[model samples]
Target: MAHRPDTLEHAPLGRDSAYPEQYDAGLLYPIPRAANRAPLGIDDDKLPFVGEDEWHAFEVSWLNGRGKPIVAVARFRLPANSPNLIESKSWKLYLNSLNQTRFASREDVQRTLLRDLAAAAGGSVSVELLGVDDSELVPQRLPGECLDDLDIDVSDYTPSAAHLAVGEVIVEETLYSHLLKSNCPVTGQPDWGSVLIRYKGPKIDREGLLRYLIGYRQHQDFHEHCVEHIFTDLMQLAKPEELLVLARYVRRGGLDISPWRATPGLTPPSPLRLARQ
Candidate 1:
């Protein structure tokens, strides 16, 4: 309970591939879910891509069996660069598989969850059970300072109108998250999460940083792909001396995707809550 609900807590008919508003199939009230549908475009050659990466995760969730709805969060670490980046919707689907499971033991439940999610993700995942009674987990990193509490300003730059040429920015470790929740302009779904950005470069324009992030307000792509595109764009325009970009999402259907990218030699800082994977 130390984190948000694992159930699909969005307004029904949102943009998940299977349950879009277009489907008009009614809301997924009994706890919606997903997995592995996001990574489909990973190796697209048309995009002036950046680096390669691997994704690992340990996700957790379960049915109360007691008739009461219980929200669960599993915590685990992923390698900084594993070779298995997952497809997001597939992740939602995998987590939903647990919707009907009646866990007999918390330990057994945790073990099974880790195994299944890892397999579905095409990578290994870890699971740390956060009891059903726990309070929703909010970032311990901030409160009144949280971006969720602020009025955000949109970016002035156009993503389609690149900066003409590539540029780079370098800076010490710093992390930021926003609910600016943007979805694929094409699909119109909400992509939620707190993104962690760390790098050592010539220093990026903070406003530009904000603008660049806003550019994705209507952009469409998977969580991993989005981060990679951003990383690639910045390295070309800002030309950072060194950089690492990561996005750790809150669970959507008992599954969460945390994507990390670094320009070799730069060690991305791991949140104490995250696994060292």
Candidate 2:
């Protein structure tokens, strides 16, 4: 979906706010997903794929009942059908509020987060708080074939599905690229990420897919929107019988957002933190 020029004006992004040191759920901002989905011809009832957004908060902290500081990592998984998404800047501000607040226990903190975030998202959001020492917090690489070594001329910056091609042969494969880059809708700041494409259908032309992915270099949109665009493009162009599109973006403001879309019957992949994240 193309960037909505007016949405940024209503959001707290590219602006300042009174950061609360106390736990205040009002600090969270929710942007309606329909605003962006409408442009892509994607409505709530006509979703093309099923998936979830896995978000990692690396700098989570709070004061204990005894006035001792405690730190942990947070993972939030929001379903793709959620009516809204929490703004990154607002989420960061909300998390910072917990820093000076005192909680009786980690369970209390988790309950608060689950309630506040789910209210903001307009849906049920799964929350997980892991200790800093938890081995599950280990960083892992995406499993796929890297396609960054292609030597091709890339001059076009606008997205074009014409760049996608499917050969006469049929095969199942997974392809990925670490060169995915896009600009933030509000700040125009660069967002670097990697993309993974897996499907069971006609073999996609590697060069064409790479070019299509790179065409977003100058595009300005949220990480989730870009993944939806890629999914819709491939479904229309390549017509893959079974398809999955996942984007892993680097952290910005101590938070990273990863979105994945797949066919109805297929389960989504587990979350992983790449070295860049």
* Candidate models: Cα lDDT each: 0.49, 0.87
Off by over 4 Å in 2: 1-6
Write candidate 2's Cα lDDT for 54-117 as tens digits: 8999889999998899998999988999988788998898898999999999999999999999
lDDT of 1 by residue, 1-277 (tens): 0122333344223444542212111221221112222233333323332333323333434556574534565555444233344344444545555655666667766776556545433355566666544443433442112333335566442353253233353355464656434563334666776555665566655544655666666665556657776666666666666766766555544455666677776544444223211
Compute each candidate's TM-score over C-alphas: 0.57, 0.95
Q: Candidate 2 overall Cα lDDT vs. reference?
A: 0.87
Q: What is the number of residue pairs that collide in model 1?
A: 46
